[model samples]
Target: MREFDSYPTPEARERELADLVAKASATIPGTELIEYGRSVEHRPLHVVRVPSPAAGAVPRVLVCANTHGPEFIGNRVCVGMLAKLIEDPPPPLRRLHERAELWLAPCLNPDGYARTHALDGVGSLARLRHNHRGVDLNRNWPLPAGARRLPLPGAGSSTPGDATYRGPAPLSEPETAALDQLLTSQKFHASANLHSFMGTLFPPRVRTRADSLAYARLCEALRQAQPHTRYLRIASRVFDTFTGEQEDHQHHTHGCWSVCVECFSFRASLAQSFARRVPLFWRFNPRDPRPWVDNDVPAVAAFLLAALDLPPPVSPRASRTDP
Candidate 1:
């Protein structure tokens, strides 16, 4: 319904995604729509479920996007994959849907997402990174070892105004708490939190050899998803120890094999004509997310699908027993 290869505004995207999920639930055999919780601004947090009809215990894999609002490309990626599953799933993807329970939450931060669209001129770029309360949701999770507070020196900022502010406490914001509650309630074998404008794929900081091997296989699978698009692993020296990050928190608390996927660009670069035409905030996402959706949805979906075959995370007691 939208213009060919054009992106939707936040409001339009939300309605379309909800409609797509509703259609999938009505038409697709095993699809269902799930409302997990509400965002701080009271927007519904949605998860589109692609459940397996087969009898035995099927592993669950979650694909979530828009954790950081301005990075909206992943939202379309989720929609495209969900549509593919409903319409004409490829052989491998069909197999994935058959073998695993797939859950997709396309837009996790609606307030920030809307803020990106609501602002005029440079305001969008300036306010795109934080929620309405000015907290960076991605940087607001509890640290490893069940620590609630991130050390002030390395926690980005104690004040709420900064882009990377870790918030007054871990999971202080409603968006992060809703996500955390989802993890606590359901056991996901693996999860991928999608972001954009950094063109990197960062696997969680894994502890065991089994987890490492599983993570490596996932990395390779994602790389193979896009023929020319290179997916880089986040380096250990810097990104491995970011306090209160979602990937770190997911793995630390639930033993879920999680990854942070940054797509679209390695760095922010703009086409000469397009940059002059649109606001700076639009540049954070791909100029046209539709093309990226066609190229990367399968790859993103494949990463979640591939988790079904990977080694499950080590049990907490076993992990504790190891060195």
Candidate 2:
């Protein structure tokens, strides 16, 4: 068995991620690193693009992780997926690469990620979830036209210090604005926002029956493609409230088949709960990340491939019904 330490420190993580991108680009044909935007702290935000082997305009897929600071396992899984794609892609990933252009953003919230590692498990978990200016990047996305924020639990908060604060306005933060620009320009056919510890796949809140069914089928593909343990597919129901989440924004505004992939497992969380003093970070990420990485990488590939197989959305600016 391989012995592993806790998650990497901020500086080490940045250096390692850059090195991984550089290596991938150097070894793999058509793989390039793009610096799309910078975070509030001036940390460069990058996406590693792996162009499809096929000719002409093909579908595009985006896999981004670590929007929240403490969920470091998502970053690991994204890196592992990229490595698998370049080194030895399985059937689904190979098919995906052959059919579509893939972009991997390993760490979306670098500022928040750095802050969490800097704390060294010393601060509140809520504080670790926000960016440098204390804004929740995941909840900072623009809502669909005419869709209002319903009064519901876990939707988001207006309070500055709260965990799910949605910032002053949509696209207010540099990180989210950068991602929005990327999504606008790329218009990906499918996207997966990697999160941790929930052990479920959450599809965006759909307004139409057709859209809901499409998401259900896409999530089922993700569930069936897992070689190891499978996660629950949590499809959004009609009455579900709209949170200013990235998946929702991607699906509604960009017409992308998007899902919030809650990696890790409730079983892992249960095990961590037995510890006398488990830090918030350990609760979200396992000690050895290999198992989860091995499990999720292929599932994500299958999900993206399945999305490409589905029919395209009605329109890029299609309006979704308000709750």
Candidate 3:
């Protein structure tokens, strides 16, 4: 068993992911790993597919992490979950694999992750959040061309170096485009884009009553898996929302049920009296990866399981009877 307590740099992270895929393929009956695309600095984006047993067109669920460079906790959670499933899948989990397909993209922003690692260490919170080109990958989705402006106060930024800088145009960044391609190419029943430092599980916008109920059950399943976690229905209200985001694009454009998960929280600044000097990175990511992985990965796994069992969301008109 690999000790996931410490964080890995970009190269190390890629190697770890490769190792995970290799081991999984050797151990699990049907595990496939593919190089989906490349980052700005040419880092290969890898996706691991775990097929179902009853396999004629099973519902696909995407579990992606590390869209934001500094928020690495989700990546750890995802990797841990994959490891668990590969190593010793519980009977229920085995049943899940027998019914639904699982896809995982562990690190989406390799350039930024590597850049941040080059600039700062574990104790230093001065990490880089944007890619090598300084664009925020989360904000670079292919939203309508006009919606690509400086986002509202809490939404996103227009400034290149700023943390929330939405690029000059939608799908402008390669990383976002690569992910966009994946979402658009295949039909994913649901997706969980993992993020961090907030400790909350958010469901995408729920417009209809059926959508609301389905999400409620899904959130409950996640909560049941990790009782300490909080479930927020509309993430927009919490973060004030932004365009070109993965969850929003997945749900709206691709018709996939998607949510951005804030994996774990840690604020070193609030913990000590000498907090004035520590950088923001120290505050954004957890120091040790074990607790966060142990608590949140199961919740993610449970959510995927719940999604498989959930009835498809019905439109308002479809749910209403003509009088």
lDDT for model 3 comes to 0.69
Best by lDDT: 2
Badly placed stretches (over 4 Å) of model 1 are: 1-5, 124-126, 146-155, 237-239, 271-278, 315-323
CA deviation > 4 Å runs, candidate 3: 1-5, 90-92, 121-127, 144-151, 227-242, 266-276, 311-323
Ranking by TM-score: 2, 1, 3
Query: Which is the leading candidate under TM-score?
Result: 2
Candidate 2 segments whose C-alpha is farther than 4 A from its true place: 1-6, 315-323
lDDT of 3 by residue, 1-323 (tens): 02223778777887888888888888666787888889988988888987776737888888999887777777888888788888776444566677788899998988777766665633222147777787878867654222333336635566666667777877778888888788767678888888876666667554556665677777777767774545454443333443557775676567777777877643432462133565455555666777777777777777778887765443221111111
Q: Each model's TM-score?
A: 0.86, 0.94, 0.84
| lDDT: worst 10-residue window of model 1 | 314-323
1-323 per-residue lDDT for model 1 (tens digits): 12223557767887887787778777666677788889888988988887776679888888888877677687877777888877887555677777888888988888887777666324643277787788888778766652334345545566666667767777778888888889888878888888876678888665556677777888778778764566777645333554567777677678777888886764433552253766655566666676676667777767777777767676451111101
For model 2 the local lDDT of residue 59 reads: 89
Query: lDDT tens string, model 2, 1-323?
Result: 01225567767777777777777777667787889999999998989898887999998999999999889899999988888876787788889988999999999999888887767644786789899989888878877777889767678777798888888888889999999899999989999999998899999888888888888888888888888879998775767777789998888788888999999998877787665576677778888788888888989999999998787676457434333
Each candidate: how many clashes? 0, 0, 2
Candidate ordering by lDDT (highest first): 2, 1, 3
